[model samples]
Target: MSTLDQDLASQIERLRAEGCEIIRSEKVSGASRDGRGELEIVLQFLRSGDELVVARLDRLGRDTRDVLNIIHECESRGAFVTVLDPHVTTRGEMGHVILTVLGMVAQMERRFIKERQKDGIERAKASGRYLGGKRRIDRHVVRELLAQGQSVAAAARTLGCSRMQIYRIIGEAPPAV
Candidate 1:
């Protein structure tokens, strides 16, 4: 069998050995996307003894707040969460503590990434090499559209952009001939 099949078979084997019955197994389809189908299944079907199993904690959420909220919501409904790869789960007191620490680390990591990105942008600007982001709507096109009596909102809609972009283009465009 394939690696995924083998892994799933083993998980089923382990869960069954631990006296747990498998009711349904589902796949979450996207990275950092809401697992709508998986969540609906859990909230709709899980009983008091049921465990919501995932391959990893990140599968449950993109950050600490999201993960904690998911855990709280599951627990409030009398269901527990089980993460398999490292065996961290919401099934015990110690698991909660570990999960909390891991979640905090994830949140801090995200903050650090954003700060690094901002620092990089500032350095680029200081070096006189930063020319802002690529223009979404061409200023010439915006000016032509405006000269043709198009409204700012209409120009934004035509350009698949926002009013802010239209306003910026207006500020940059030279006087009409």
Candidate 2:
């Protein structure tokens, strides 16, 4: 298994040892709630006295507002949130204060990471070492195929890209087939 997968498994094992009955995990980015179905389910099914545990505050969310919103939602449903790394919980008012500070720190760290990434990209561009992402589909080839009267589906199949991508390259809507 990958390092992240192994780490998640280890965390789950540790939680189980600590008597945590239910666990929710997802491999998606914590940058936003989009595509995080597991988290949604946990929030939806949370009951009074229930606890939402995460390996770290950042694992819950990278954005300060998003993390606070999640914690608020849990609290609104009479559930508590627990972060295992630094060991914070919503069992007391102090926990709320600590979690808010941690959430802000996480959001600041995310911003710093983005800034570092942007600086690195700029340096690479200056050194002529950055070429951006490699083209997955050749627009010329896609255009030629479409000009040859190939259906959008046929072109997509030939190019190993989605029809949406083909349409995007051709700069036209999909013709009804």
Candidate 3:
């Protein structure tokens, strides 16, 4: 088998010996530093029948509600999480308390960061320095693609942009024949 498979096998064996039950699930969504890579990793762990271990709580989830829900679901299934960093585990009362505090702190940090970013953006805009991001595909081109009977998804794929962006441009475009 592949090296990753072998390592996963070893991890499963270790968890079984620790008297821990593992059940993986994929009903989750989140963002990551690499944009869309978090979904892939979460899917991988979910497919492996593993408890989805992480070195820290933030490594497992992005938002407080999402994190708590995942933890609750995992626990309800007789599985437990073992966070290595900050040494938090969601298997007992103290662990639950610590996890709760950490989750709240993470959410607060996210809110603070968002507020700071908004203030910076407003300052930049006031100074006429906020040019926003580059326009990947022109609005006229997006309109033409839609006029050619292309669906939003297809037009976005053709233009190498998001469906939301396609919709935005299309909304600004004049009525297509």
| Ranking of candidates on lDDT, top first | 2, 1, 3
Instruction: Answer with 1 or 2, whichever has the higher TM-score.
Output: 2
Deviating ranges (above 4 Å) for candidate 2: 137-150, 153-164, 171-177
Cα lDDT of model 3 by residue, 1-177, tens digit: 997567556655654665656433232334232344544455445532345565457656767786787777667656676776687787678988888888888888878988999999999999999999887788878878888999999999998888998878766747557
Candidate 1 TM-score to native: 0.60
Model 1 lDDT per residue over 51-142, tens place: 78766565566478778887887898898988775788888899999888877776777778889999999999999988998866678888
lDDT of each: 0.75, 0.91, 0.69
Ranking of candidates on TM-score, top first? 2, 3, 1
Candidate 1 pairs with clashing backbones: none
- Which ten residues in a row are the worst by lDDT in model 1? 24-33
TM-scores for all candidates? 0.60, 0.83, 0.63
- Mark the 10 consecutive residues where model 2 has the least summed lDDT: 168-177
lDDT of 2 by residue, 1-177 (tens): 899989899989978977898887889989999999999999999999899988889899999899999999999999999999899999999999999999999999999999999999999999999999898987778878988999999999998889999877777554466
Worst 10 residues of 3 by lDDT: 24-33
Better of 2 and 3 by lDDT: 2
